[model samples]
Target: MEEEKRRLIMYEKLMAEIDLGIHAIDDSGKTVIYNQKISDIENMNPQEVLHKPVREVFKFNEGQGSTLHRAMTEGYDFRDEKQTYFNNKGVEITTVNNTFPVMHHGEVIGALEVTKDITRLKRLVQENMNNGTRRYRFQDIIGRSEPLEEVIEHAKRATRTNSSVLIVGETGTGKELFAQSIHNESSRSAGPFVSQNCAALPESLIEGILFGTAKGAFTGAENRPGLFEQAEGGTLLLDEMNSLSPDLQSKLLRVIQEKTVRRVGDTKERKIDIRLLATMNEDPVDAITNGRLRKDLYYRLSVVSLFVPPLRERMEDLAPLSEYFISKYNDLFQLEVEGISTEVRKLLASYHWPGNIRELEHVIEGAMNLITEEKYIEFTHLPLQFKRKRPRPPEHNEIFHEEESTPLLKDYLFQQEKTFMQRVLKEHNYRVQETAAAIGISRQSLQYRMKKLGIQKIRE
Candidate 1:
């Protein structure tokens, strides 16, 4: 009886403070005591809450004493981070609650229930999860070329590790896309996948944006969370890591090494638990030599490095992707576009695509906009530069085989420019300017090639 009096005194004292919706109910289901927060959440006064049956508020039995029914029946604590509740007005809200039975001399006497309104919190979390661009798994990466396959294989391998990743590729090569796929496939998929382009922001604002400042720490008056803190237990992709200035690079290195960060102008050190994945277009070696990127940060980031081959190098993936893009744009533009013809295929195959797959996609869509077709994409629909030809007839053996041929960079395209130039001058009766223009070179450059190739023009 003395212990019961002590419990009542403690509950009364707790009622004066402790606000996150706390309530106590006797085994008879009477609201023995409750805090103001509960009444506030229910929009009722404390005087209005006393002596009420908890069943009238909860609309269901809480279980034996404070114990969860599932726990008593299943031999473990029954827990759910999400549970929906509805009010009398048919207004629905989410809640997370924890309950335990009060034991008095081995007999269940009462229950304590702690609940929080999570309806708004759940909405924010769901919004973050449904950010579908990153939600795409490996199966979503649309490519089948050997080079593309290699990248996908590497990305899959990368998903299993927490090590930092450095994806090197030219701009628009889907480096960030690969990073997102990796994060989605990893164990951290349940957590936030935050991404920011380091190159896109200037050095002055980059630090503040990355490591948030406290209230009154800067021009902003509100306390804001940085990407690192927000990405706790998740992945942080620093797109274009190579562009970070040396000072910022040092700060980034410390975060990776120690897993900590200090908010701007705040002496307190906040620890961050984040997985790091970054992309860079510039060569690491060149960046190091030129002092644009720090070598230490590069070493830290490249715990695993992946290269996305240029599009010209992966042309084997061209035809199918081209056809796919044509169809895609046709649907997007509401055009009745058809597939590429044999002649158009020849143009796409022979040209050196410096821009890669992204460039090819743009080229296809651009062509689709101008043409009206149903059966074939004519050669005239291609980019203008692709139409220009070498003056000499067939400098290359020209593989015009069926689409089943192996996709790989051809060796003949690596032939000496001078030899090709000589063949062009000899065939064109040494009209240097016309020959130079036809083969995509200047006359002076052609003359230099003639001197180098020992080709004498038939001077009139």
Candidate 2:
């Protein structure tokens, strides 16, 4: 009995020292031990909670899920169960708990509950989901490609200065991730980091929300500080910059130049201190030509341009990114997914990925949801779109039935080169500049290839 008493004392000491909340109840549901951490979380004294009934102590809502009650009454163990309630002060609290029935000699004796507070983190995640972006640091970016590495290095350098940065990439290329990373790395990281989508709002509201509006400025107008003032001494991200009207673009240029803004109906200009990061979905040059973006504003905003390569260009990262997403979703959905099959990996790598990483993540997530009791994800578990038959050229055996009819490698290479040049020329309507840029080569190089391949522009 003395040895058992000593063990119980040691267990109590260990539980008290730990940071997370822990509380255990006796067989009759009366509290046996309530530690200091639980006291702190509940904003109540340990003395008040000691020797109380479990349901009374927690005030569990009758119909709502109750981890402690279920574990004790049903003799079941629950892991990572979420519970929410109001504390003594009427403050709402959210927690993830592991509640288990304490057994002795193959019979249920009591119940113990361990909890960790995740209220703040949960709120932030919800905000990000609603806004289409989140706070992320450099470590969150997953990539090993040379182009991606170069861009990361450039973004790190950009954090040292207050110059405007323009991140140019196609949609779903993680422009917002880079912007948030820069903000987190900058010297003013402790300050607020605000993001707004220029394309998500109308022009009139966009301007007011960005530059603030004084009372009497318009109907139902109230004096307010816009995103600029809210992000004082910090960073502001303008997403989809090309969507801003020319007049708004001009105003933004003036704000960047003068370092001041005048709220509507107010003549007083407020001096501001902020770092700006802007993102564009389409090519900036195309935006300029289409008059969707002002050229001078582009030059000013792109003082440090960081280009994020599309997924198709960094095919080597597909496997690692896939594994990362799998691990992430496994934690999220509580699955036992070991990894993707070799055939599935190859299929993912070969995909054109017009939607880039975002689309790949959706595919993996969709597949994971349908996978059950599988050690590894297989090609058969992939989405139906992936199951669709893809056309292929004749196989080697079909192309050369005769044993002596082996084709030379150089001849095959020449045919492939000719086909690629013709396809690119046709896609660009034979325009030298567009075709060269699309092919990621200089116009002179494209011209040389055209002459070598004897390819001509197609007429409509």
Candidate 3:
């Protein structure tokens, strides 16, 4: 009897800890087990739902009812069926449920359900549908480098025709910016422009999102137009297209070829008149070799391919990009920050930007936030993480005297302390109180150190 009790406790603990929601009910529709996850998803307490009928605890619109109840009564099983219903508190909840009938002695006794909450995703999709404004233009692209200009010229030409364009570049290389520019410059500029990241959602959900679902298609699917249909007259930019599964790549290829999309679980094909743009973060050849992208789809989409060069490949644009970002943040933060210092510029140019322009923008933004009553962004203003990227100088023990070739430990320590104090003082904008607190020293001690070290705020 003690062993049986321990096993039941273990089962209850497992159910409570699992990420997915778990709920079960008896044949008479009385709630038997309701885990914490399900309670959280439904926004109801276990005390309110336990030993109560599902119909009494939750409200479902006519023709759309509980999957658990259906599984118990009809002996039916549902897989990846989306259900939207109101809980006892009158809060609407959306979930993807897999329900199965529980059987004992050849008779259905209850039903069990596992659910995944997708309420946030549903709201995001709705927001994307409502907000279809095209904000980026060709002029918005910042670089004037040869490689960037060449790509811009090609993108400008792509806008003349409705050919599908494939953009290839590393991550953070502004592939979406180019895609948006092309769409805004295209003939369909007046129409709705929608962009979706193919990797943002799972295959099951993405398939339905990309291709509209018909009513009666799944458990709770409504008659809704997909992104292709929503972007009827404009361009649809699918970011990270290479992340899509091979099966989806095939379906996309068919749509590109026929200019029509068949809704999921629906036979009727609807024609679409819109330009398609896709961006891949990796090389297309690599993606195709790895079987993540379909060869046929690549050919169809690459009718007009534009390769945006990474920031490392176009170093000439660094100065202009940096200045532009400074001006942008100047207006944004309402500051008169004139420009970056020469030392900071050298550091910016020396680092190979693995994250490309986005990283540079963020670095500048961060440095600007630390500035107050300073005209130029200095080396000290850079974030600590970026500062760590600077090349390490010789260690104190490694520094040798010219005559003895022995370590100058005393001189090295004095220089290091002076540099550290100066940097900390500058970081706090020459505020003695803040600098003292930052360095964990009393105000008098910090003042004496500054006097001994000859560290004073110097304006450029």
Where is model 3 more than 4 Å wrong at Cα?
A: 13-19, 23-36, 39-93, 96-116, 390-460
Error of 2 at 295 (Å): 0.4
- What pairs collide in candidate 1? 66-100, 66-101, 67-101, 311-356
Backbone clashes in candidate 1 total: 4
TM-scores of the candidates in the order shown: 0.56, 0.58, 0.70
Runs in model 1 deviating more than 4 A are 1-133, 383-460
The digit string of per-residue lDDT tens for model 2 on 384-438 reads 8756733112222222233433344533575788888888788878898899899
Better of 2 and 3 by lDDT: 3
Pick by lDDT: 1 or 3, better one: 3
lDDT per model, in order? Answer: 0.69, 0.78, 0.84
Candidate order by decreasing lDDT? 3, 2, 1
Per-residue lDDT of candidate 3, residues 1-460 (tens digit):
6999999999989988998899999989989999999988988999999999999999998998889999988898998888889987788899989999999998999999999887865875786686566589989998788778988999999999999999988788899889888988888989888889888878778888888889778756768788899899998989999999888888998898899999988999999999999999876765776898887898899888887887866878989899999999999999999998988877777666768899899999999999999999999999898997532123422222233333245445657889899888888888888888887866755764564455654532
When summed lDDT is taken over every stretch of 10 residues in candidate 2, the lowest stretch is 391-400
